[model samples]
Target: MSLVLLLFVLSKGFKGSRVRDVRVRGFGTGGVDTWQTTPSVGWSRIVPKFHAAIVKFDIAYPYGKKHEEYTKLSAAGRGSPELLVAEVGVKDYGDMENMDLAERFGVTKEDFPKVKFFVNGKDKPFDFDGEFNAEELKKFIRRHSEVYIGLEGCLETFDRIVDRFMTTENQSDKKGLLRKAEDEWDKLKSPSDQQIAETYVKIMRKVLEKGGEFISLEKTRVEGLMIGRITKEKKEEMQGRLNVLKSFTHDEL
Candidate 1:
């Protein structure tokens, strides 16, 4: 595939990073099980931009096994603004009426359309494609979307890199590869980020030693479908928020 090089501009003399608020929904039959959301409190620190927070509703147990852990994390400021609302579903009209939620969290029914509920609250309209609102919604969705990874694939890839370094005798090359390996290990749970930085560098150096010119990247689909689908304007507005750096690389023939 063809390669696309992206030109990015960095703000001059900018010392403070933009603090980002992340709203993660683990919706299914049950809102993100409390046990699962607990670990994300620590993981959230890895991305300093995102201040840890949760907006949840329960379809299962009122409280999960790790409920106390999440509560503690929130109390310590590690997980801020963790809203645990139970029996959450798509309450279009009800959500809109609840001025308390709309004004406080800004999480209206329009923001989440997949799930619906019959609740005792004001309902909100789902106006995603209103001409003016369309543009704004597009921008919000792109920045707020989540990134997922396959843990097994990541570990196997890291092990392969470590094995390659163990067999190499050149001191300089060995040092470079091992450093790359450690970086990969740190972000193994995040394949896309690790791919652009650590994985690409390691593979390129290895191929150069073997007199090869082309490199390869394996792309995986969730539910057998491609995930990234932000609108053009949304893409331009969201730069560092969603790092699509790998999209610029050349695909192997």
Candidate 2:
């Protein structure tokens, strides 16, 4: 499907509310059932099913930029069965049924857009303390969970190679993985795919030549160029390179 049409379908797919006795579905696989109300009982019953769940605690009728960014994140994460993106809406007045539940999680009305990530094997959810950009949210998910959510300009197959390439102490293993990445790059058909694949191969080559430290040094150099006086096209190019570099360094969020 075209990118625009796919986004439209993902936006529409994220529907349903009220956590009470609801059957929560995977975000990427099919329609996701989110919660409009924050009930402790509901969270206890449903959150355990998924490997990773990102829950947003906000006002009942949320709007404005932050909410829009969250919508983008929901759409971006719509293809991953390993992740669940949801919202828990709390009423500020009237019965205030969800207030206590929100308080239990340390979320307050003052912070209307608090986010928490719950992984299946963890006792407490990790708080999302970063900005609400869709790509940043994806990185946050990847950092905390085993789920693979590719950042823009990153190829998953090459990213897996990068993981092994960074971890293994054996130089021979690293060289073999770099060769494998080049072979994969050659097999890609489209120009855009080849362009992105080339970044992966180039980075692998640089890391092999300069050692593991090249990832950080090159990332710093790209980041510097991004902030300098550069054309829009150049800035975008740097951003793509930065994204690919991030795949090599998991410590970066």
Query: Which candidate has the top score in lDDT?
Result: 2
lDDT for model 2: 0.75
In the range 63-166, model 1's lDDT, one tens digit per residue, is 54334333332232211222111122223343232223333334554454222221112233222232222223222222232211111112334444544554
Q: TM-score for all predictions? A: 0.26, 0.82
Candidate 1, number of clashes: 14
Error of 1 at 36 (Å): 17
Q: Which residue pairs collide, candidate 2? A: 18-36, 28-78
User: What's the lDDT for residue 74 in model 1?
Assistant: 27
Please give the range of 10 consecutive residues that has the lowest summed lDDT in model 2: 21-30
lDDT of 1: 0.31
**lDDT score at residue 170, model 2, on the 0-100 scale:** 94
lDDT of 2 by residue, 179-206 (tens): 9999999999989889999999988899
RMSD of 2: 5.2
